[model samples]
Target: MNTRSFSFRLLAWYTCLLTCIFVLLCALLYLDLSRFLEHNVEQSQVRRAHQITDTFLATIGKTGPSYVAGQAKALYEPEISDRFVRITQANGPIIYASGMPKDGSFDPAEVPAFPPVSSRESFHRVKLSNGKTLVIAALNYHGPGKTSYVVESGALLDPAELNHLVLQLLIGLPVAVVIITVGGYILVRRALTPVERITRAAEQITQHNLSERLPVSRTGDELERLSISLNRMIARLDDAFQNSKRFVADASHELRTPLTILRGELETLIENARLDPEVRERATSMFEETVRLTRIVEQLFTLSRLDAGEAQAEWSRFDLAGLAKTTAEQMSLLAEDKNITIACDAGQAVVVEGDAARLKQVVVNLLDNAIKYTQSGGAVQLHVRRANGHAILEVEDNGVGIPSEALPHVFERFYRVDQIRSGEFEGAGLGLSIAKSICSAHGAEIEATSVPRKGSCFRVTLPLSKN
Candidate 1:
């Protein structure tokens, strides 16, 4: 499935390298072997020619030149030898011709004007008019009474041996390549087995399992070093996660008690009969501020619980569509003040299993956001339906739309994009964060999509009750 994984890439590179090395080695071997075989043929031709000349010189005092030519002719054997031997005098008279071309294009009276021997013999490749190739070796021999004769021998350069070598390469190369490639793949897979284990272990590690560490190998190689580094990183993450949990717990305990006492004192002061109207009004304002602070603290507490996995959903079968409609009805009064229409489409009964109170809170928060952001006379629509065995809730408003850059962080805790409009819409930005936490606790998903100046839509999807 992961074609570009490290093992696959390594195997591919190994295959390519193997192919290059084999091809280069094969090319070098073929060239060397061909040269060696050609050299042997040339040497054999030179040796045979010299032997014939030596025999001719040894018998010169006993026999005539015609008799020596007759003796040389007797040595011709066409069946096993590829060489054609010929003896000729210096005056261009052919004395003997062995295995002459059947095409009769050769002129025996005119011996091939081969260059005189520079070393022991001279060799040249010659092509006959009949399209036959041969290597010709010539040796000019000096005999008795200052007489000279040329001993010339020819061997045909048949391509049978080269063809056999090419055939072996063509058949053997692919088999060798296949074997090497498979072996390379096996080696690469074995080498990366530890990485696979690390991958599976890493996948199982969520925030809930930050204490888990990747398995380390003792091979003292790169993989071992990688595992060690990864374990260190995981340990750091676990420490950070624990610290965050502790801070959240400590902050909740430190802040809530003071805010509650302040709100209670403000209530008692406002209720005093001796309190002046201005003093009572100030107390009321302080109470409101205390209440706002308490709500923000509670929201932060909820998010921390969600992150720490301390919150559990109280699952119950309920009509999700009915829940959306009730939330819309409660928020419709605020929409009315802005002359905006709040349309509820919770006409269908989509039964789902989730915490009813948390689900209701999600719908309420979404409707509240939609109503708050929508302009006067703009419309907000709440739609709930059962599609594909899931409950779908959508809240769409045609107001000043969210900017694209701010969309992704809209649900992050205390992240507000419309900083300039905070004066008018004043609050700690925890509504969306709380909604997202509740959704996740219910095994549901919530997503928002928006375009600048074109409004936004928040969609929540919850699974239907199995019953």
Candidate 2:
């Protein structure tokens, strides 16, 4: 898991908070449990002290202190039971006291005498030399003859049970934390699944597919709202793109008639034998510019139609290798004018499905570009092959290769390499853009790669025709 991802961070914070709360609750429970057990032990001690006073000490007037001591030792057996007992007269004399316990858990001689009590009953805790805690409950007793005495009973506090509870909690805490952390991770992933879906859908909604919308979940949560908002944004973008394409198509159509008439008039003027030399030269220049403009306008119209999905009506299955071979042959004549050689490798037939005319345009554009950029006497090679169910076409040239920074934008409309913008190689820069639009309409991909000062290669991959 990525620690920087939202789900991981959320799970981390949740686990930390849960652990802190769990530790706090366990601490409080342990403390409350220990206090409850201690209170029960104190109550038991108080009951034992009352038993010593009422059952044995109450008979002091009838029998003697000697008889009471005999009865406590024989009946109660304080020493064997690991209990402490003592009795004192109102003045100061200690009448009865327990000896060392049978287990030797504590030395009874280390126990202190009970202090004088203002109330009828009292309790005290003492720490012995053996690192044991002793809880003593004392009661003041009055005999039948107005004889007064203090009765004390105590037992050592044993932490064995509380220690067992601590061990259990200690063992269970990590297990509980692990289980909760796993559960929290799962919940976080499920919660963010919609966002992930939205991200993937948004990535696919580029300018080519502006009409597509992200899937909207009807859960009425933030994810739903986000999807709806993104859909609205895409709708606005689609409208803007439609308007732009409409303007380009309309403008290009309107300019064609005027350009045609201007070219014809210039041709007629140039043919006139009586025209001045300077006027004829200017007319020829104007004619050339008009031809260039007309070509750009025609390319723009084609690109707009491709963008609008109007070029798919002429889909057909044809051999891609044959098409590449034919287009390379035709473009080679132009390459010869520059003293450039053209090589075509169409060894085997690789068939594909698309608008044949548009695919031909793509090949023509790539070949023209390679021939235009290659140095005189340099070579251009066109390769066609079938690989992994796709038809691959590559156009490579030993030209002044495009810079690495400009390779990505070479197919963008009107983008020209700054280094190669000389008048001799000047162009309106719409050929590659038109080719890329046509490729996208046919579900093909076009990419360029170059080694500066070495050569450049443009590759087109189209899915093979199943038929």
Candidate 3:
């Protein structure tokens, strides 16, 4: 009962959700990538610092400021003030350092540890006990592992720069999000316009108005296919509804005649019970009427089971031609009494997988109808062949054919021809219908074609059995 259209809303929400997810993923990737680049740059800078230190240590060994400004330490400028570098020797005495290695008391304890403890890059920033941050890099040279020159460097990060980067991201994210939200909504709405039309069309269609169909652009896209499919469904619904209504009307009319006869016989017997013969005759007639009614009910139940997909076939591979020949042979007598000849043209062996017993019944029913309805001296031919992956079983009779308008209704249940209304020739009119149902259950199709006073042919096509 809740009939809200979900096309545009669902599309919009999906677009927004996808956009948000991608944006978050991009944001995380950007931050991680930036950190990775920065870490690699810091490592490279540290490696360079270590190389500078190693050069000095290789030239100068174990000496104090008394040997300051050694020839090997001349490349380092003292003007690079924020960093400290030095070459030391045995007993940890500074033999050379920055400041042209000028005489100065730059105490080792106050200057901080040379390559401030680090796991990678031989580099780190450390705060001295007196409150100054220094970045250091080192390499051991001209001595055992610990005895070496040390190089240190520093670059202070401004507090304002960090704040500015954060501000840029915060401001840009909202603007992008707002623009994407609006644009995505508009785009989704435009894309789903056809869907919205389908929804509205579906809403407007009721049982009485199933003739209404969804509008189709026929663009061959999924949405267009959806519209076409919906329209087809509506067309089928309208057709099925009409068939049901007609079936009900026809069924009621067919049943009423037998019931009317039964009632009339019963009413006559009660009114004239004193006439024993008449009463017995009336009772017998009523019994026959009841039997006919029972037959109709059983056929209806059988068709219902077939329609509901409850009929399972007991399948086996068998010769369709053999069955056709046998059925035609048996019907020869009935045809002969009307001066009608029965001939068969069965080929080598048309094999098909199906319910053999059920299929034989279909053949027998068709043959019986052909014989019963054919004029005297008319011929009934049974042909069985294999063609196009199907076992074609055909029954053609030169008899009183059905009208073209009535051909479509011949397979419908309880449809009897007006010309064959006599009790002897008249049947329950369920033979062809039951035959059709059986063939359908076995994955086959049966059709009948007829021309008035000319002839009729019923064809049953069954898939040929590979086995």
| Candidate models: Cα lDDT each | 0.81, 0.88, 0.69
Check candidate 2 and list the clashing pairs: none
291-356 per-residue lDDT for model 1 (tens digits): 988988887877777677644557678898888888888888888998989998888899998788
Q: Scored by Cα lDDT, where does model 3 land?
A: 0.69
TM-scores of all models? 0.76, 0.94, 0.43
Best model per TM-score: 2
Best by lDDT: 2
Question: Clashing residue pairs, candidate 1?
Answer: none
Candidate 3 shows a clash count of: 0
Model 3: worst 10 consecutive residues (lDDT sum): 100-109
Ranking of candidates on TM-score, top first: 2, 1, 3
Give me the overall lDDT of model 2. 0.88
lDDT (0-100) at residue 51 of candidate 2?
Answer: 84
Each candidate: how many clashes? 0, 0, 0
Off by over 4 Å in 2: 419-424
Clashing pairs in 3: none
